[model samples]
Each structure stands twice: as C-alpha cells, then as structure tokens.
Target: MIIQGFYNIIDKTLALQFAAPDAMKDPFYVDAYNALNHFTGSQIVTEIPLKEMQSYINIATQYASQTYNLQWAFSVMMGMGAAMNFSMAYGRRNITKMKELSGNGFTSTILFSCITAFGVFCIVYPGWNAVFITSQMGSHYNVITEHLCWTYTIPLLAAAPLMFLSYFFMSMLRSEGKMLWVVLMIVSSLLVNCGAGIFFMHVCHLQLSGAMMGTVFAWLVQIIWGLIIVFGVKGSYLKFGWKDMLFLKWQNIVAFMKAGLPNFINNAALVITSFALTTLVVQLPNQSYNNGISILQELYSSITPWMTIVLSAGIGLTQGARSIIAYNYGAKKYNRIWQVLKRVSILIIIWFTLMLVVFICFGGLMMQAFAFPKEYVPQYRWWIVINFMTYPCCAFTYIALTLFQGINKSMLGTFTSSLRTFLVILPLIGIGYAVSMATGNPIYFFVFIGLNDLISSCIIVPILVHYWFKYRQKLVDLPDDFRSTSINEETFKDSLEHLSKTEVTAAKEQTTPPTKKQS
Candidate 1:
C-alpha cells in the first residue's frame, strides 16, 4: 500500500469526490477498464502490483460487467486470449518468436478492444436503452445508463492498448528479474495518471471523462518509455520483417492457443457469468420490499477497490512464484518446480489466514474509506462481513489457479475456472436469486456470493490437484515455429523463415550419410 500510496490516495479521495453534496456520480468514475481487460498469467504480475493499476481493474469494471453488451464481452475474451499467448511465449523464453507474437497479440487484441469500444461508442447516438442497458438497473438509470456505457467503452479503448503493449515489456523485464525497472515504469505511469487526471478535471474541466483522459495520458507515457528502454538495449529487440506476418502459421497459433487460450477463456467466462449474475441479483421479484438493492450494489462496488489492496498483496506472492515457476519449467527443473509450488502453498495458507483475520476484525474501517452515506451503513457493514467470510476461499482458489497457469497447464486451469465460474458459481447464484424471490430476502442473494466461493474452492482445489499429479513430469507442447532457445538476430530471422517454409521442407530433414570406413 505504501509503494502504491498514490492510488490509495486517489481512491480514498474519490470517495469524497463523488460522494460530495454537489458530486457528479456519472463521469468522474473509477477506472472501468477491467471489465473489458483480463490480463492473462504474467500480465497479472505486471499490471496488478501497483495500487493504481490494480484499481484500474476497479469495482466499476466489475459492476459494469452486468451492464456492458456482447461486443465488450468478446473484447475481454480476445484480450485475455492475447495475454495468454504473450505469457506462454515468455515462459518458454521464445525470445526469437516474441516479436511476431507481440506484433500479432498487440495489434489484434487492441484492434478488437478498440473496435468493440468504437462499436459501443457508435451506439451513443441513442438505442442504449434497448441494446446495452439490459441490466435490471436499466429502468432505474434510464438515459444515464446508456450514457455511462458509451463513455465507459472509451476508457476500455484507451486502457486495453496501453496494457497490451506494456505487458510485452513487463513480461520480458520480469523474466530477466529486472524488478527495479518494472517498479519505475509502473510508478511513473501512476504519476502521469494522477497528474493528467487532476489537470483534466481541474484545468480542462472534462469532469468524468477527464478521468479517462488522465488514464490515457499515463499509459501513453508508459508505452513510450517502455519502447525506448526496450529498443535502446543493444541487440535486445528481435529483428523482424513485414514478410514474417504475410502468411499465417495456423499450427503455431493453434499450438500457442492450446496452452494459452484457456486462461483467456477462464477469465472471460467468469466476467461473462458475473455479468449475467449481476443482472439477476439486482432484480428480485420482491425488490421493492427490500430497500432497493441497486443502491446497496452500487455502494458495494466501492468495497472492491479496498479489497483489491488485500487481493493484490496475495497475488503479489503468487506472481513472484509464477515467474519463478515459468522460468524453471522452461529449464526442465522439475524438483525446483515442485519446491516452488510447495512454498507458495505454505505462503498462501499463512497469507490468507492473516488476511481473513484482519478483515474480520477491521473490515468496517476499510469500508469507511468509501465514505458511504450514513443511512447505508448497515447494508454496507452486512456486505463487508459476508465478503470477509469468502476471502480464504478466494485466496486458495487464486493460488491454485495461478499454479496451473504458471507451469503452462492452462487448459486445466481454464477448465477449472470455467467450471467454477459458469457451472458451479453462477448456478449457485441463480439458486440464491430463486431463494430471494421466494423468501423476499436480499441477504440470501448476497450470501450466495460467499457460498459460491466455498463451493468453487471445494470443486476447484480437487481438480487442480488431480491434474497436478496427472501432468507432473510431462513436457509442455512447443509451438511449431520453435527452432531453438538460443537468442540471436540471424537465428530469429531463420525462425521466421521456418514458419514460411514449404510443407515438404518443414516435414522432412536432409542429411548426408558418412562414408563407410571399409570403403
């Protein structure tokens, strides 16, 4: 929190900024990019450590899940797809292949995220009521809902590109253990984000949109600085030509996606499911009897930013372990890999136990950071306690999920995530809605949120362990373009050439037989 002190200040200030008597609730919104952004595997390590970036995946992003439409949804799916591919390439230390992968991943994912944003933006001329505002709050927010959706997508457009490009460098620096440089990049971005945000709000008076402007400025700086440092390093940047991307390598893409795409799917599935679940939870048949769940839900959104502080701390450990695991996996150090897992597990147990205890004790104080209205105190407190009970379950599930991802068992990880999110958790939430409608109790609805975590932990932990044994010593699949791990510009170009080779040349190797000694 101290290292990320700026964001804590920003968020704590936001509670005051938005909650003011003359406060504008609509535009000066918290960062909403997270709804559309799912950083796969190592990007989690890069982006989540700083408080500002972590909150960039803020409560608004989560809350917006229920509000955004299919286009925004698919962008998340593909964005995670891109993130997964980048992390896997780095895990293999496929430096030669990274240029092409980075090019494709950045260009393709940003295009999708931005195009989807523009697609959403285009709807701003109206029709939001029928299309994007399908959430239960749709009726309540009226035109406001549609307007926020339009502006929200703009931030996703700005944020997704910044995050995607930076992840390439963040992944590389992290792999090489250049921790100092990574911190500098992140902190510098935070500073720019703050400076730009304040300037836009105070000087330019862009109001809520100024927040988006601030974010874009910060990320643009990070991207520029990152590229400079990267190209500045002599002999570091991989050599590439336009010819390299002319033809598609279906097999290589498939192979990378096979190991990588699951992380994307798992995350995307969770977001999509959460979006649906949010729609259901906000609209109980007896909603009027309960003092309006939307206000509570909106207020509840504030808690996640603070919760992110704790979650980020826990993830910090998992990410460090992930980097170590990925590097060792590439080196084929099985014993070392197992050791890392064991250490992470022990750490998780200790960390989660302490986290839950702290939350249980001081959780109310944490809520005070949000500066909720006095009347909402009871509702806020109830939500906090219910959320606190699930922290341990959440911690275990995350560590387990990250473990599968780190060693590149992303398919299993994806399977576990999809099952937990779609099949198990959402169904449980559905049941909660059923009970709430039957009993006219909104608390039942929120209790299910905690219950889903428990049920998911029960299911996910077992599946993860089963797969851990199943694939314990197995080798990871290599992309078809993988020639060697050696880092050289000429060899890198040759690697690209290998991708473009004729079918017969790639399929068959040539060699001259040694002359017989007898002859």
Candidate 2:
C-alpha cells in the first residue's frame, strides 16, 4: 500500500504540475480543451469547487489503496497457497508419477505471477511516461513514438528474468524436498523489492522508472536465491538428477498447451476487442467520451496488478477443494463428496459476492484520485461504475473453470472463457460502437460494457445448470451396493449358516451308521 501510494503521489503531483499547464497554453492542449469545452459547454474548469475535487481525489486514492494492498497480498497469499497445495497433492508420489502429470500447479502459478508482475510494470510504465511527457510537452503525441523508440524497452527486458525465476521456484516447489527453500526465496525477493522501491523509486526521485528498476532488481535478487537453492540445498529427496532433464517428456508440454491455450486466447481476444472499442470511442463526436476512455484506461491499469491476487487466491482454494471432492467421488464416497462440494460452493459464492459489493460501492472515488485533467471527470465516474460490475461474473467463471480443471474436463472450462471473450465481450463492443455512432449517444458504449457481463452470465448459468443435472443423473443411476461391492457381507453370512446346517446333518448320519454296525 505504501509503495503504491508513493507512486500515486508522485504521478499525481508531476502530472498536475507539469502536464496540465503545458497542456492548457499549448495549441494541442487548447484543441483538447476546446473539444471538451464544446461538448460540455460549461466552464467546468473553474465551475467545479475545491471540495468536489478533494472528494474525487480521496475516492480515487482509496480505490488505489484497496487495489494495491489487495494485489500484493493476493500475490503473496496465492503463491504460498499454490506452493502448499502442490506439495500436499503431489509430494508423496514417486518422481515418475509426478513427471507424467501435466498441471505443474506450482510452476504454472509462479510463472503467471511473475508474468503478471512484469506485465503490470510494462503496462504501467508506458502510461506513466505518457503522463510525464504529456505534462512536459503539453500533448499526447510524442509519447507513443517514444514508447516505440527506446525509453520503455528496459522494463520489458527486466521482466524476462522475473518470469524465468518464477519458473524455477515453481519447479523447486514441485521437486521432492524444497518447500521451505522456495518460501525463503519468495520472502527474500519481496524484502529486496520493498527496500529498493521505498528508497530508489520513492525517495530518490526515479518515479515510475525507478519503480520498474526496483522491481527488476528484486528479480535479480530472486534469481540468485533460486541458484542457491538448486545448488546448495542437499537431502535424500533433493538428489539433483540429470536424468529427468536428459529425457524431458513432450506430454507435459502438450498437456499444458491443452489446458492453457484457451485462456491465453481468451485474454488476447479481450485485449484486441478493448482496443477496438477504445478506437471506436475516440472516433465519437463527444470529447467527454474520448477523454473518459483515456483516463479510465489508466485507472484500470492501476487496478490490474491485483488481479493476480484475486485469481491466485481463488484458483488455489478452488483447485484444492475440487481435488479433495473429486478424489472422494472416485473412491465411491458419494455422500461425503457431495456434502463437501455443496459447502465449498456456498463459501465461494459468498466470497465473490462481497468483492462485487466493495468494488461497485467504492469504484468512482478511486478513479477520481488518478486526477485526470478536470474536463473529463464526469465520463470517468460513469465508466468506473459501469466497468467493475463484471467482477462477480468473472469471479464465478474463475472458480467454475478451476473445478473443471480438477475433474480433468478442462475443455468445458476453456469453452466457458472462450464464450465470454469472443462471444459476449467482442460482440457487445461492436453493438456498442454501432449504437453509439448511429445515435450519437456515448452512454451506449458504457451500457454495452456492462451488458456484456450480464450476457456472459446468461450463457454461463444455463451451462452450469446443465452440468449439475448431468452429474446428478449419473449419481441416481448408480446401484444401491455399487459403493461397497468389493466385499459382499450378505452372501458371506448366508454361506456360514448353510455350512453349519450341513455339519449337523453329517454328525447325525455318522451316529446312525455306528448303530447298524453294532447290530
């Protein structure tokens, strides 16, 4: 929270002081100012009171505050939870069995986490530069060219090592005896990040650049920590063998692609669709809509880092919960598994509901804190409220998808996400663009984004219902004693009673035969 707040303060201070002035006097700024002036037709700049401005800033700050704390905590908690779950699930198994498995739960979690951190920084760095340079140059033109040039490339390069080290820790977590070591590695990396971020990024005046540099430096520290664990740690389970590497199986790669490719496609398509919608919005006659989209994008970027936290924690618990339930079902403990699944499902729903409420209630004030140019505030507020309503639907999908993964029916999970991205989001964007352009109503764009999730829910709810019924039907078809058919208790008791009766008859016959011999 502190690190995030520090960056927020620097960004707000610099953008307002440097960018806003240059933007006002300069023609480019004049053009933007005029465009907004024409659309709003109110002298909003001076008309808005300081009290409102302060209120906006306070709300925006709180949103950033929640996002920063939630994201970091989420990342840490998810990493730890994933590590623990992977250990408990696969730890006791032989290496051969472990190698054959595809999920590599710990590895996937860590890699995505590292990628998320890197992406967050990469995505934020560009916008940060935009804020700074636009403040300095008084326009948004050169920033794009500079982004293509050289200023932002280092952060992208820095992200590579973070991803690699994440892979390594994930591997270590999967290895026979290194849970504690992996925990230490993560802790050490975080400490380095905290110290450097506070000193260099905050105190030393590097701003966003320093923030990126500090994160990269933390990865470097983590890489060293990984090497120490790989080389120095010694134990019976830690016999570092070259054999496994000599014959890396292709099946692992295939399995990962099967499970992950859909998700990748889902996100990539969403990004493309978002870009298209933004372009459409920018083309709108309303300056407020265009400017609103721009600022909202930045606020959205700020909130994205914490998605790792939400997904990580949600995915971890769901994976563990599903596995336990699925195993019991496989062992024919039908009643027990059914009871457990119901309880867990209820808890997950409650948790998701709470998150929805928080984001919806506090979203606007949060966007305001980013302190976008004064002219665009109205549109920004509307979009913030509209954009976050998708959270509940997203959370539900995430948990459901994890459950599908658990049951080895991951295809269904992939399909659900695919439908959400391509079918729901993209189409709604097209409709939004068409409606907004034809009618000259910018609110349609806002309405469309919100409607997409509702549509996604419509599709998803039925599928989930079908899944429940299909599984329920299978349960009803099971035989009464199918659960314990391995030992037939009734048949064994019947055999014992017959055997006793036969023995009594044989004894009576033996006594009669002895009397005839005597005669």
Candidate 3:
C-alpha cells in the first residue's frame, strides 16, 4: 500500500552496493534489500493524536510466549498528530486554530515532500544512470538500466505530493470517522488503480511508471473526493482555499515543525537501529555460524509479508481507537483517554495474540502455504514463536507513544520511540549473542528482538505513571472562540445519553420497588 516494486527496486540495488557481485540472492543481498527502504524511507510526519495504554499485569500471565505486530504504525503518527490537533482545536471550537494546524500540516507535508522528491530525482538518478558509487570490485549502481531507473523513479517522484496530500486530507476524514464515504472513495480508487496499474505494468509495458501513475490517479480520486467533502460539507470546520493551502504560513509551519521534528528524529533513529540490527544478522556468519544464519535470513525474507499483516492488523485497531482518544484528549476528557486506551489495548492484545498463536501453532501449515522447505519449518516456527513475545510490549509502547503525542507530549513520544530503538534494543543483542554462543542456540537472536521490546516497556512504564499523575485532571483551555460542538460531545456524552440512559433509568425504576404505588 505504501510504495510499489518500483521503490523496492532500490532495495535490490542497495544490496548491489554492499554485496559481492557474484552473490546476488545470498543473505547479504536479502538483508540489505529488505532493510534499504526501511532505513531510508522518509516517514515521521508527526501530524497525530495518541492513545494511553491498559492494565500492566505481568506479561507472562497474559500472553505467555506468543506475540503479534504492524509495518507502518508509526507512519500514522504524522496523520495522527494533525488529526488530533485539529480535533483538539475543533473541540475547543477554535476554527482558526484547527485550520491553521490542518493547513500547515497538509501544506508542509505536500510541499516539502514534492520538493524533496524532485531533489532526489536530480541527485539520486545520475548516481544510478550516469555517475556511480564504486566498490573495490568496481561500481555497483552500474547494473541498473537507465530506462528502468527512469520508469520507477519519475512516477514515484511525481506521485509524492499527491500521495502525501491525499494522506493529509484522509487523516481528517479518518479522525472524524467519515468511514462510509471515505471507504467508498478509497475502494473505488484502489480498484481502478489495481486495474490500471495492471494494464500499465503488463499490457502497456510501462512497468513501474504505470504502477506509479495508477497510484497518482488514485490519489487524484481521493483529492477530488476530499475537496468536495471538505468544502461541500460545512460542519467539519477544516475549510481551506488556495491561499490557505498553497500560500506559506510561517507561524503554522513553525508550530508544526516544533511539534513534529522529534517524530522525524525518532523515525530516523528507529530505521538506523533496525539497519544496525540487520547488520548483526549479516555479520553473524563471521561469528561462529553455519547454514542456520543464512536460513534465518531467508526466513526473515519469506515471512515478511505475513509479519506485515500481523503488524497492520494490530495497529489498525489503534488507528480506529486513535480518533476516540484524540477527540477526547482535545475535549479535555483525560480519563476517557485512559479508558479508551485500556479498551483498545485489550482489543489489540487479544487480536494480535490470536494472530500469533494461529501463525505459530500452524507453523507447518504456513510454511507449506509459502512453499518453504519442510525443513525450514522449525526455524520459521522459532522465529514467530520467539519474536511473538514482543507483540503485547510493542502494542503497549506504540499506543503509549501515540497517546503521549496526542496529549501534546510530542517530545516524550519521540523519546519513547528513540529510546526503544537506539538505547534499549541494540544493547541487548550482546546478551542474545552470548546466550546463543554459550548454548548453541541460533534462535536466541530473534529472542533479543522481543526482549528489547519488553525491556523498553519496562523503561517507559514509569514515564506513563508520571504523566498520568501530572495530567490526569488536565483540561483543554477553552477560550472565547472555543465552543463544544455536537461532534466533540457526541463521542463521550452520547454514549451514555444515546445508548445507556434508558437502560440505566429502567434499571433504577425496577430496583426502587415501585414505591408500592402508594398502596
């Protein structure tokens, strides 16, 4: 859903930069290919709202050993920031503030991304098509065709502004729970894109460009749909014109940048940490290894899609919950944030736990499905089984980070993620390696991945406790311009008013003994 094979083409090329020429499909290439876009893919939008977490009873008692997770959960951080901030402003009835945040978030992301994409086309292309980064074994970038390079790069580059702009608009609808229309538009665009992209990739032989154009056109659909609704619908209070969207607002940009820069840093740090972690796997053969290490690399590549599904589903729950939390946080209902957090965390945990158990328990079935060697089953099983330990931890930490940002503790959110990747996770590998060496267990490497999450959770628990204590009774500062809208109240108020009032009154009347009817 993010980038197509055109973007992934770089993943393969990055390996060419690092790996020996003869080794095309070996572990180095495999790891490097997978990790390339991951390390350098520019996420960290920081336009977000967030969620608190739930009961922290012993994780061992909870999930025992199994786990689950998401791919671009953090990417949502950007949209969440904007959506939440907009919601907050709306809750306070500050249309100016809401529009300011939305305008800046949307404008900054689109303008900056498009500019950066073009710059990348200029800088990155010549290195591939003309100039080359040489190895001692000669240039690696030379292998790519100028035609193929231009095909994927151009459309993707051109698609940047549209993609990000669509995302910014979608975030508003997403936060407002504008599901049916948004979903309809999305489904339609996606169907068309799939059909068109297929035609381009196959019939037209446009390859990556077709795929990217399909994406660009899909965004066009969203752009049209979003504009109609944002302008046509009056209540959202998110209206903007060319001046609002295109014209630069230094103040809003400064505000967003101040709030959002940390997320960018956190994102970059996580990628760097992940790449460093992958390098450990790449370097493992040098340590004392066998075919097991290479097998691990292949295993990582094979199950990546499945892993992404697990991650996507787990975070998808949070995405739904994010709006509730964001709106509440904006309305100054802090306790509701806690309540929403608990409920969402439980749902996510249960869902991910089920996913992990099913995947692990059906390990052989999964391997068979992927047509992996039956002998690969044990390591594959071990990979999911061991890393599954982190599912709850990862979910908890992500929710916490998001919520922290939602409540405008953006710095804390950044720190939480940065610490998880750079500080907690990387350091634990030595122990994992030592255990693996001493006990001759290759699976311990994966164990450290989960262990890092668990330890990071431990590190962040106190932070949450402190924040809860400090901001528990916090309320949004309602000024003259601020008015509590039906939208804001409907979420928290109407649940009791619309759904529970009749039942509660009936229960009270029935339990009151009817006063004997004065008889």
Number of the predicted model whose TM-score against the real structure is largest: 1
Task: Write down the lDDT that model 2 would get.
Answer: 0.47
lDDT per residue for candidate 2 within 184-251, as digits (tens), equals 66566666656665565446644334444555566677667765655576532222345543444455
Q: Where is model 3 more than 4 Å wrong at Cα?
A: 1-78, 118-154, 207-214, 261-270, 286-295, 363-375, 429-442, 469-519
Give the 10-residue window scoring lowest on summed lDDT in candidate 1: 18-27
lDDT of 1 by residue, 1-519 (tens): 123324444623532343221123222321222222444554432221233322222333444433332443354344334444544555556765656654554455455556655655454334544343445354344333344434544554546556455544555455455567768877888888777777766676554455556656765776676666656755543323464345445654554455545545654565566566556655755443112125444445556556546655664566566667766666566667678878887877787678778766766666655544445565557666775576567666666766776777776667665665576777777787789888987777778767766777888777767867887666353333434664555877887877768655745644434469834
Q: In model 1, where do residues sit more than 4 Å from their true spots? A: 1-95, 118-125, 128-130, 134-138, 145-149, 158-160, 234-257, 285-293, 310-320, 467-519
Model 3: lowest-lDDT 10 consecutive positions? 51-60
Ranking by lDDT: 1, 3, 2
Residues 1-519 of candidate 3 have per-residue lDDT tens digits of 222212222222222222112223334333443343243435422211110000000110011001100111222344555676676666565655666676667767766665555555554354553221111002212122222334444665556667666666777777666766667767777666666666665566554456556666777888888888877986766776566667766866655554454455555555454444443453443333212223443344345445545655654565556666767766767667788778877776676668767776775665444324456575467676776666667766666755775667767777886666577776777677667667766677778777777788888878878877887666333334343443343465766686687998888887875456664
TM-score of each: 0.72, 0.59, 0.67
The 10 consecutive residues of candidate 2 with the worst lDDT sum are: 130-139
Residue 293, model 1, lDDT: 27
- Measured over all alpha carbons after superposition, the RMSD of each candidate to the real structure, in angstroms, is 11.6, 13.6, 16.1
